[model samples]
Target: MSAKKRERPPVPEILPAPVVDSHTHLDACGAETAADVAVLLDRAESAGVTRVVTVADDIESAKWVVDASTWDSRVFAAVAVHPTRTKDFDDAQRSGVERLARAERVVAVGETGLDYYWDYSPPDAQQDAFRWHIDLAKRVGKPLMIHDRDAHEDVLRILEEEGAPDDVVFHCFSGDAEMARRCVDAGYVLSFAGTVTFKNASTLRESARFVPRGQFLVETDAPFLTPHPFRGAPNEPYCTAYTVRNLADLREEPVEMIANAVRETAERVFRLPTVTRG
Candidate 1:
């Protein structure tokens, strides 16, 4: 057996307009310290990605995002136990997450939803946690960022049954055009990642085309899902430009247009903070 080869594409030119990475994992990206975070964010800023919403897939990550958001004006936080890890969700963990979710800079409740692809946890447990997170988001009056994988039907069903939060985002959207239309009709925002740029992702590209400019967002989901020509490479927020540019090309729209749309949508949904202190 041999190790699979990965490509590391050079960073593309900076985007013309600033954009935001709606779903990324700062800690997983190896930005464990404020200094490391600053360096990563600086590279992203130089590439015109001025803001980011770091998401937590577990409790420790949830805590980290909350603390990191306070350190960097450009960072916002989204906290939740991911679907695969929802097996660990309990009263104590929920209480901690709830306390942090109400923190000044925590903007959304998520990276939570259903993932049938990986059976790390049983289906019912995942659903239970998903529903709980939904309730928490509604009560807190914050947007919900969903992580739907091979379980789209169940994910949507749960949302409908629970009366989804006022603002819902499908981070790293992985559905076909029809699902995209449904999400748009239901007022859910779809966040695109580098996967949309892959050759085999025609359905994703179609879904992107079907999305109205204001209803879609762009993200890096960094430390994973690197864009085409660079797929399999370690990802970072600075690589957001590549995904944004590819999205623009896919939609046959100007790069600046896509950038501005995502940036504005992110600000509205996540209530981004100023990148500099007043």
Candidate 2:
């Protein structure tokens, strides 16, 4: 017998206001060309996910993301060599990422930081690459998008040591309430992904509740982390609609309010152009 295939969740109703998926992987989400990107974005727009910041995880993706951003007005890009891939981040890789980071549509330098869960890259190498990315963000005047997994303490210490960029966002933030508070105090924005909607993610839920407006954002990290009820299903930018609704319920705020707050925060943090809905 064959294993069952998970069904993709039906797109939730359009949000009351537009929101942004602060981080995602268009390439990983099965988009290979401009038309494929459009199909996904079209679904997202219907659900009121007006814009997205597609992030890169390696040198090839860094280049692809920059090109994808140019293919559509609603798409923006973030380029970085993810922590696990930094084991052999040579000069060519560094220069490639740096060059792409300067692209007009590349709004942030990130999906970078330490990942202790995977032993793919040694801690020392990850830390070194992280520091370099921090400086790159500062030099390019862009927000630093982080990918902190289980190495919260080290990630924080390194940021303090390197003098974090003007804007820093912990993408798919996995810390507890105290860590959230620390990041908030330091003016670092926490971006919640579908994990916050999991039944067992009480700590993440608590952090979501604790983060004040303007200090937090939402993302799909899609092609992964599909919101609950659709947990194992394939995820895309459109699924962000489900997460946004769940967040409103979690925070006990109106849906439209949560939508507007994250949208505004993303625009300011990424310096993205204001998206006016027709």
Candidate 3:
């Protein structure tokens, strides 16, 4: 029998306004094929994702992330061991992470913080690894990208004790108003993701409502938390528009206004040269 030709899916449409996905993990999703990067970037660029910060959950992923960012000018990198993988941060791994952090494509350190919900790693080890990443970011003079999953108190405490850099961000923020206020008070940027669009996200929405215009950012965290209608499907960077729209609705503002805010905050946090980093 002759092989059947695979159908080409229609190109995903772009949002009318520009945006910047401040956080994502392009290299991790199992479904994302090698060809998807360009196609995904094309769709994202069309949908106004001028830039994206692809976070690495561990030392090895950081290298792939760097390679992806290097291959595509639109993508930048954040490197570190996630809380779940804190056990992986042995001496050799720690040194390698530090070296990767110093890479030109690495703009921040993390996807690292506390994840008490999973507790895949010991709490003490997570804390130690979190502190190490923060210190590495400080030493390298780069920003810090935090991932706090149901461990807000511990995350905040560590950041305070470590004296988090001026450019700290809670990527995929899922905290309450108080946490939002604390982050704002500490001058940390909050990057919202697809989860913000979930119906049960009142607290997250409340936090988003309070985030200052400039201190707020948006992202896809794609190939994972597919937003709303796309939920249950494997997410891609192109679907970020749904997140942008959801954010605008929650903010009771025009999509364009939120788009501009997202772009601005993403540039500030990621220090991308294209947007208003000033």
Each model's C-alpha lDDT? 0.89, 0.94, 0.80
Give the lowest summed-lDDT range of ten residues in model 2. Answer: 1-10
Model 3: runs farther than 4 Å from truth? 1-13, 30-35, 275-278
lDDT of 3 by residue, 1-278 (tens): 12221222233556666777778888755424446667667767776676778889877788888778877787788889888998657999998889888889788988888888886798999999999888898899989888889899989988889898879989889899998999999999988888888988888888988788999888778767878765666666766788888888888998878878878777767677755322
TM-score of each: 0.95, 0.98, 0.91
Off by over 4 Å in 2: 1-5
lDDT of 1 by residue, 111-205 (tens): 89999999899999999999999999999999999999999899999999999999999999999999998999999999999899999999999
Give the RMSD in angstroms, all C-alphas superposed, for model 3.
Answer: 4.3
Pairwise lDDT winner, candidates 2 and 3: 2
Highest TM-score among the candidates is held by which one?
Answer: 2
Residue pairs with colliding backbones in model 2 are none
Candidate 1 whole-model C-alpha lDDT, 0 to 1 = 0.89
Report the Cα lDDT for residue 143, model 1: 97
The count of backbone overlaps in candidate 2 is: 0
Selected candidate, larger lDDT, 1 vs 2: 2
Q: Which prediction has more favorable TM-score, 1 or 3?
A: 1
